[model samples]
Target: MSTETKEKYEKYYVPEQSPWPIVGAIGLFLLAFGGGNFIQQTTGKYGNEGSWGWLIFLVGLSIILYMMWSWWRDTVRESMGGLYSSQMDRSFRQGMLWFITSEVMFFAAFFGGLFYARTMVMPWLGGEGNNAMTHALLWPEFIPSWPMVETPAGDTTTAMGAFGLPAINTAILLTSSWTLTIAHHALIKGNRNTLINYTVITALLGVIFLCLQAYEYYEAYHHMGLTLGSGIYGSTFFMLTGFHGLHVTIGTIFLIVLSIRCASGHFKPENHFAFEAGAWYWHFVDVVWLFLFIFVYIL
Candidate 1:
């Protein structure tokens, strides 16, 4: 290309081949396999042992953490080195948007299942409409309910209420979202100290939310008898909340890393896509939790 042509068109920086993608894929496979085994073992589904499952799961988790740190570190280095251009920034934003869209679809599937179970399966089993014969052959005494606490095989459990821990968690997440917004505003206004303070607070709020969720799970398993084996209700409940908790954990780590970078004098007012991406993710998480609170808990 001619010098003038080359000068007119900015070149995108293409990094060397990286090993993180395959490493991340392997880690995800291990995590999914081990997690499946662990669930089966805990529920006595296939007589599998839980210990090995836990081990593999933790190993996978560690590998994933390492992969994320290394990959993100490289990205940060590239960003700080001024290798990224406006086109690259747009690419990053688009990537994050698509990522969040995938996440939305993921949660939508779960919510769809919940809807199908409630509207179709539960009512059919309860002998509603023309399904009386089907109900007789299946679960004769099954009652159509919003929170089905009894299994067909006579396993009974309590439904979680929206008044306690769930409500508190909702408040916590909302507050964190507000704090994060403040932090973002502060960053834009060049108020570094306020930015750091609110960001830290948001991270702490996420940790607190996770801790409370853990306690809620403990209570569910122990006191309420609400377990993975407690029929479709239990399965759906745990699946929705557990996956959401995992997202919160990841978002918390995202915020924590951003905060650390902030403290290290990274991210400027004009060029801070990393911070913006993190905020976008956290806001998405908060919205998902709101839906969970409403449909899964209150309604």
Candidate 2:
């Protein structure tokens, strides 16, 4: 082998096979099955004892959490011990980028659903195109409007106007993205303390955004009388916004992990796939929330 090839292969350190992935898969399976059962029970399609399903789902979630911590802990140990090579770093970067792209597609599906409901389905139902008689028979009072101020079933919710909390959250998320970027810069410059400080600030902003979102949901559901079961309008509203909230939750966890890694001196100025991966995921999340704010809340 050439000297370069020999060095590359020699430098790379692949760990032995581990059992965490399989355990994580089982945890996910349990969560999925239990969640399905719980939802069915909530909608009265299943027996009243669906609390068992929820209990099982929580157990699965706990298991998954434990698995993630253990698996990542092992990975971090290997990384800090200087086991990864340039090729390994490239692989990690590519994988994280692809994962973020998949998340983009996931959010895109929800956005597409919102657009179709507003522009096509509701309009067709209001006699805008070929279904006049059907429209008259179904919902004579149905009006097609963007932001969906009213539903055919008479459940009305004031659109979450974009002025107060939503706008504040937008600013918060945008600032968090900037803070994370600063942290990344600090990491690259080997400013460990500065990097840690910026990362913690970014994570705190994420927590603040989540808190605001919780209050927003409460205001929508309780005061505005808008709920998941309200109608198609409410269903689409909750589904799109709710899933985005879940993504935010995951991104927060990602940042928290990054902060811990940074504090532990796990990353260096030259090589830090773990830090980059967390930053990529966080930026992806920030972009998705921007779209949600504009399309779901503002527009």
Candidate 3:
């Protein structure tokens, strides 16, 4: 190492300005606009816009995804080219920490709403607490029940059983967590082949889990007649499990990327922040699934 290189404290590399952020913002705007119109038109059936909203939504989604891929690809190239210093690495780690924290709070908001609706809103409608007048004025026949399968307006749907498909999905996720840990250990031991094999297995398990969830959704909609219109049960069920499934999808992609990078020898035993970050995210996704299994499904 050159003495001059070692002594250069002010050599922080600053990347040039990029237009990806603005592009991403435009993508988000289009998505929100199209999504709102699509939902309203589809659910209410009162709009002149039929399928154009959906097409616009897809375009926006594609744009956002392309932006993410390009931005991250450039960042990865920079890191691999050794343009990042120790300070930059710290910044990356901190950024990941804050991002994960934000995700946690996002899920917390949904769970909080779920609990409030289940515990308070339903109860108040069923003559509990000081809401007897509310019960009398609105939904006089509304019965307060945990898993309110029947709506106040007499709509009905079946509650999903916990021990059937959900149990299988839980097992699959747990196994994936184990396989990922094995891969991480193999990486630490410099066993590239084992790492790749186990990581691939983890990704496969994620795929299987998603397939099962999709089938479960089909069963709910087809045979069981459960949907967003079914009641609060369907709403919370989909809200919690649906978002978690999205996370699993993202985590599966993360694992696949890491597996490719591993095959190309992108990580070392001592310096693999990308791999560690992916592992942390996968584990967080797994933990959230566990909570959903217990509270959303079993309870």
**lDDT winner among the candidates?**
1
List residue ranges in candidate 2 displaced over 4 A: 1-10, 36-53
Higher-scoring candidate on TM-score, 2 or 3: 3
lDDT of 1 by residue, 1-299 (tens): 89988899977888889999999999999999889888988887677667589788988999999999999999999999999998899999999999999999999999999999999998989898999999999987777988998887898999999999999999999999999999999999999999999999999999999999999999999999999999999999999999999999999999999999889889789999999999999999999999999999988
In TM-score terms, candidate 2 sits at 0.90
Stretches of model 1 off by over 4 angstroms after superposition: 1-4, 49-51
Which pairs of residues clash in candidate 1, taking residues 3 or more apart in a chain or in different chains? Answer: none
User: After superposition, which runs of candidate 3 have C-alpha atoms over 4 Å from their true positions?
Assistant: 1-10, 41-51
Q: What is the lDDT of every predicted structure here?
A: 0.94, 0.83, 0.87
lDDT of 3 at 46: 69
Candidate with the greatest TM-score versus the true structure: 1
**All candidates: CA RMSD (Å):** 1.2, 2.5, 2.5
lDDT of 3 by residue, 183-259 (tens): 99999999999999999999999999999999999999899978866778887888789889978988988898888
Tens digit of lDDT per residue, candidate 2, span 195-248? 999999999999999999899989987888766656666767778777787778
